[model samples]
Target chain A: MGLSIPVGMAEVKASKTADDSLSALGLGSCIGVCVYDPRARVAGLAHVMLPDSAVIRATDRVVEGKFADTAVPALVQRVESLGARRADLRAAIAGGAQVFSFATSSPALAIGSRNAEAVVAALKTAGIPLLAQDCGGTVGRTVTLDVASGLVRVRVVGGEPVDLYRLG
Target chain B: MRDAGRPGATGSLSGDAGTGTRGILFMAFEAEGITELQLDALREVGNIGAGHAATALADLLGEEIDITVPTAGLRRTEEIAASPEAAEAMVVGVLFIVEGDAGGVIVYVFSEADARFLSDRLMGLEPGTTQQIDEMGCSMLGEVGNILSGSFVTALAEFTHLDFGLSPPNVAVDTLATILSEITVTAEALGELSLELDTHFVQQSGQLEGRFYYLMDRDSLGAILGALGMAG
Candidate 1:
């Protein structure tokens, strides 16, 4: 019932305002990592596009939230910066769909499952507990995180938003 | 390669008109890094490439088809996903991986309604009869997109004298933002700057329409521009 600040690709956003909601729309082969601190009422979301930043290290375009290895840690840090304790943060993720079900050697086409795995591995490396995840399918999704209640939701195209997980 | 990631360099030439062809006012390609002269050369390439593509599409549909003036630019994954038309729109995308002289990805996008309509007609069924897309429909659409991509490839090959090999077409129906994100991100992750050249294919009856998107890597861009004598 409040403001919906949409998280964008390769971008990480955190909000301390209880009424604010964060969402990443139409995520295909891109993972939306949602981290929340229930006690502090802070929430953050990162729309990650690739598994590793090392692949694009040669380019100056390797932004923070563009890859799983970077996004998970960055999202945690952003929430911590917003009065949330690192240990208090918990995570839930959605998206990372194999949008095109094709047999190709390109890493991009098969990136969805790898993204899910990478995000999970990154969260583990950061010591953040992954409470729930809905990832890796043939359809794209929209992931939303409600800051006030720490509720996360997922919606496919032309479908209603359904509650996936709640952190508290 | 030098101009690939320079922000604020795009939208200089297109302005509010946005590539100036569709008349729909969607910012299909707010290009980056290329000079006006080089962009003109790229436009020439699109014109010839899409001309052949349109003919193939027309033949496939058994109807007259018109091709819009193509738009050329350098696009990042984030920018492509944030566009107004792509935000939440559902689309059918057919992808072809390009190899050989230049390597990258080319995708043809159609709105869900357009996909259904065209696929139904292609399958010799009533246009409105199909409620959901099936494997048969996807295969039909894939072949159609493959033929059109082949035509465009032939034109590009002739223009640059470069050999191109295409992988089998892969298809998906999803939100435009997601599909586009997957593509541009792939190029970025591979450390290639994505050069986008896109055009609209419109049938006279307006019953079928689609967008053809060609995203080449930095190597391809340089090679094609050099071949055309437009490289700086």
Candidate 2:
């Protein structure tokens, strides 16, 4: 049986062993990035909460996994350290949902969409192939990346689990 | 001005006393510095707000409602996400930002069952018959959330004399973790620290129960304290 490692809010985890799974649960507006290298059987997941770390004041403690701009790079580096080459990395993302819609113009209200855009942009800048994504909806999702198969599965509340994307 | 030692004057001069008590409340987190006085003050705020909300709900439903005393505390953004109360439970949430002098997010949480029950009541249908909330149901739930949260905000505004502008309520149905994640996003944007005030609601017959969370940013909390004449 493979061990399942749970990633909490604003957290990132990567696994090299084929017998492990990285999971991020209860993703609302936050985006979960899953990166995998099929040949090396290495996988990484980041629960990103915000779009840009630059908006954060210097006095505020920066959590690398908490923002899309920072988390994508951090995930790439972590996977690379586990022997997965950046050139071989493929990415799949889930979440980034506007769970609640408000009329206000607060940037925070639209953070989910902003996080999604940031993740995609970061992946492109890193030269990682964007394989599949299940994002931008009104529902919540939980994503799991199976290292052995590189299958990214997404489960929505009150809905059946679906294989959102995969990397060969 | 009356002397501080005078019996009637002490009540009027209790602002300093309240500040001293709040200081202990903050210190209590470090050690067991929370005093009965602090708890009482917090409970009083809860009682007043919850009382008003209960009245609003009862008026809307034409039924009697009851509320438990509220509990308030300071928690990290991650801690609230990992809390057992937010683990995998299906819930309906109404979230909004409190702008103006105090900035924060107010969230109203209802279990799937409770949401269904409340929706049925709002539609004047027989209770426990509806399994899901349709569009109309969602609208009703949103309005209820608005009224409940609005009542609480009004009570706090009157008590603290602070101008609090509230954004329109946005309602969503999802797992507790998912709903909490949204709140955590707001907390992350504001600050790592969140002031969490939680309360429970029960209908007169005890058939329905709901949980409400009021999340305030650290700056908002300081403003509230300042308005209350309590040291930040």
Candidate 3:
């Protein structure tokens, strides 16, 4: 049996051992970014809640893993610290769902799509290649990344687990 | 079979006096300085609203429904998400956005078993047998949410004398954590502290036990307090 580590809301975790798996559960509008280096058998996951931390004025206490812009870099650093090379890093993403659809005019309702865009942009800035992503639907998802095979699986309510991405 | 507890009996009110000077544009009010009296006032508002909602639900299901006194307070979005009561439970959430004078969101959460019970009861199907909610079941559940939410809003409006408009209810069946994460995301985006009101519901048949959470933004909270003569 593999060791399962849970990544809570606005949390990030990285593991280098092949028998370790990182999991983020109950992701609705929040996006989970997974980066893995197959060469080093290291995987990192961040559960990001918002698109941009810069837009928030609560500078006194900022959670880096909670925003797309800061979460991507922070996740990269975590993986790198575990002996994973940035040059060998590839990423896959999940979540970013609109669980409720009412009041389309409200800026908050569009946050799912905005978070996805922000994550893509941040990954580009970090020079990481995007391998695959499953996002933008009405259902919430729980995601797990297996460090042994670099396979990311997403599970939804009343649905079978689907293999969303694999890092080569 | 879980014993239900009254809301206000579980937690106490604590105030933070240092949040007065943050002065961020959208971060107007922090969860600080809320007095016990103010909490009691909010609790009264929730009690009245829950009474009305329970009455509506009882009428719809043709059963005796009981509701506990509501607990109201200021809490961080993360705290609500991390609560053990909601962590892994499978629930059906009915979410609505309230606009106008006091804007916020209201979420009615029912456990999967309870949701199916309500839907099955409404559809005249035998209880404890139907496992899945089809399209018709979904529509029935949505209507239940509409009635309960409308009644709750009406009672609050009457008590506070504040004009309020509600968007149509959006229903989603998922884990409680997922539903809560959506609320947390919206709350963080607005840079607003959440005014969390929680209520517990029970039915005579004992087939359903549900929880409802009402979250309001800072502006809306201020408006409500101002209307009740509790604003600083």
Top candidate on TM-score is 1
TM-score of each prediction: 0.88, 0.84, 0.84
Off by over 4 Å in 1: A57-59, A105-108, B1-33, B69-71, B82-86
Worst 10 residues of 1 chain B by lDDT: B16-25
Ranking by lDDT: 1, 3, 2
lDDT of 2 by residue, B56-125 (tens): 7777777766554334566556666645555788888888777778777777788888888887787788
User: Regarding TM-score, does 1 or 2 come out ahead?
Assistant: 1
- The numbered model that scores best in DockQ is 3
Clash list (residue pairs), candidate 3:
none
What digit string (tens of lDDT, one per residue) describes model 1 on residues B1-232?
1122122232222211112222211223455667867766665566567767777787777777766533556766566654755568878889888887877787888888888888778878876987777778788889988999898888889988888988898888878877777767656655566677766777778877788877787778888889888887
* Superposed Cα deviation of residue A86, candidate 1 (Å): 1.1
Q: Tell me how far the alpha carbon of residue B142 in candidate 3 is from the true structure, in angstroms, after superposition.
A: 1.5
Off by over 4 Å in 2: A105-107, B1-47, B58-64, B69-71, B82-86, B190-193
Candidate achieving higher TM-score, 1 or 3: 1
lDDT of 2 by residue, A1-168 (tens): 788898888788999888889988999889889999998889999999888888767766678988888999999999999999998999999999988776676675687898899999989988999999999988889999999999999999867779988885
RMSD of 2: 6.8
lDDT for A145 (candidate 1): 95
Q: Given the true complex, what DockQ would model 3 score?
A: 0.62
Model 1 chain B TM at 0.81
Q: Candidate 3's residue-wise lDDT over A1-168, tens digit each? A: 789888888898999888888998888888889999999989999999888887756534577888899999999999999999999999999988888775456775788889999999999999999999999998889899999998999998667889998884
